[model samples]
Target: MIFSYFSRRRADRFAQLLDAPDKAEVESNASAYHHDAHDPELEKLLHLGRQLRQQMPVIGDQVRPDPDFRARLRQQLMDTAAARGIGVTATQEAEPDDAPQTTSVRRPGLRLGLAFAALAALLGLTGVSAASGDALPGEALYGVKRQTERAQLALAGSDVNRGQLHLEFARTRLAEAVAIADNPRLLPDVLDDMDEDSTAGVFLLTTAAVDRGEPSLLDAVDAFTSQQLPEVADLADTLEGEFRQRALTSLDLLNRIQDRSAELRRLLPCTSSDSAEVDDLGPLPQRCSALPATDEEESSSSENRDSGSQRGNDTPDTPDASPGQEVTPTPSDTSMPPSDGLPATPTPPSILPSPSTVPPSSDADSDDDSGFLEDLLRIIGDLLGR
Candidate 1:
């Protein structure tokens, strides 16, 4: 996918030449390019080949240089060689211009390989684009640069006004990302700039997106930084001990954080930056139902704040009661009648028979049974009342 995009223009040009015999001149011009730069003539040929290949599809069989065409092309190559202060080799010693000279275009095996190449090129050239860096828009590049700057500033503990300014800058970066369309390298950073704790946000965004079989958004946050987020690491070792543990990589964490921001925003105040603090560890104890409800409270506070909704795998424990112990599902049942206006009925108690009710072994009959009736009665009464 990446190579196709980067070479699309060249591919199209090659296709055009393939379809048009008159464009043999284009092929002729390309034959002069050879791999060796030490030889001026070869150097010229290499330049022309690079230009031509860069303008044509690297992998395909749509066209071949004609034998007669190549012979004539070699003459043109020699002519160019003479003009460039390089001695032209005799046509006799040079391979036939028209022998169907071949051009080799390397094929990339995966889409990411091409994308990474494009990224490298973008970095090298200071240009970002969906394809080769040639056609990048000025405004988009400026937006990304500004976003990077703002993110750095915001992260340095700047004030709200500075944060807001950074946020606005990030918005521009997002705009640039949208414009460039296929530049995944820009996405992670763009989303990062959208929040003050860009590292966490980027990590989560990368993880979730990768799971969905797409590009990860937080590409730059290192593993160490990603682990710093409470969900992915033991922040108790730091200041976020109240939060849960996670094992996501930095990019994965950031991507996930970004996703959480949307849902969290509906329940909390502040931008994604402020929200990160809450999401990393969640709202403080007063705002969060971190404590578990006791059996009695669980029954009594089903609809109230003490409902004890643990976020993830924390399960409530069952109370230890002997085999036939009765249990109340809720505490408020005794105080409130059924909403349907049914009778304010008393709960039926469970029953447990005394050991004497069953025939005992002849030898065991001598064992103590003093507390037997008392235990039986208590268990029976509790069941019957339920």
Candidate 2:
């Protein structure tokens, strides 16, 4: 157990323990990570590892090649390539057009074997990594850089490891996207890959928690969700079209976490957990009642400011009469009052019928009226004759 880290996975686990953001995460994961129980050496080593990790950035800057060293190295590369009959042109290879073809008997297999051996030596001495600090965009080894990461992620032993690996891979994708910012064609695929990785990381973490898996895994995932996922989601918005859409799909995955979140909370309660005498640690938690409507100040919102009649919304407004029924007029539906344009026409004070309209009394009156008219006409004739 003292020398267990000779195995690659154990070494990786130790590294993860060191990578933990807080003392709680490290201590929580330590028991599962190292089975040594109480090896004083391991404890000391862990403490030393933490200190080294904190100082690594400063050391890294010190080790970087100075400008003078880089210039000399570049000049030496040109001199070497020239001596080897190599061309520096962007599109063409180094070998000259008149270079002789090897038709004679030669041990091509042996030559290939030597080439492979040298490549293996280089890879071992200087491991390929996507985060290879010097691997700028358009460099030949860039593809190999990501390939190394894929190999490592493929070997990840547990879901927790896979989840962390995927997150790292997602970060690598973001870095690559930034590196090739000008490449419209490749940018979308890169961003899509990043989103997928982030989503997968969150999914695995939540699933592990739901299954009552490792507490350390749950805690680690919780940390990432609270700290990292939001930033990645915001980064997604910077992209255009389908790339952004794929990223949105992953953001949707972040939402999926709530399905298992209760389980997560049960497994790993936060420091500020206020369970209120409710043991929510069961597989099925006690259903909490929905929160009351914002009654913080004992709200008077439902207290009416105006009377229901004043607001005119009290009873349903009287329905218009269907077909033949008499309609009752509410204030809203009443007719207008009559105007001064129409006047009363009764000029007679007596309430008597017309004389022609009378029956028996009126018949005698009509006969006398006819005789008087004939006498008046005769008088006019006599006056004329005289």
Q: Pick the candidate with the highest TM-score.
A: 2
Query: Residues 312-341, candidate 2, lDDT per residue (tens digit)?
Result: 122211122123443322331222122211
lDDT of 1 by residue, 262-324 (tens): 223221211112111222212211111211322343433343223224322122111221234
TM-score of 1: 0.20
lDDT of 1 at 317: 14
Lowest lDDT block of 10, candidate 2: 271-280
Candidate 1 wrong stretches, greater than 4 Å: 1-148, 151-158, 182-386
- Give lDDT per model, in order: 0.33, 0.45
- Cα shift from native, residue 352, model 1 (Å): 60
| Candidate 2 to truth, TM | 0.33
RMSD (CA, Å), candidate 2 to true, equals 45.7
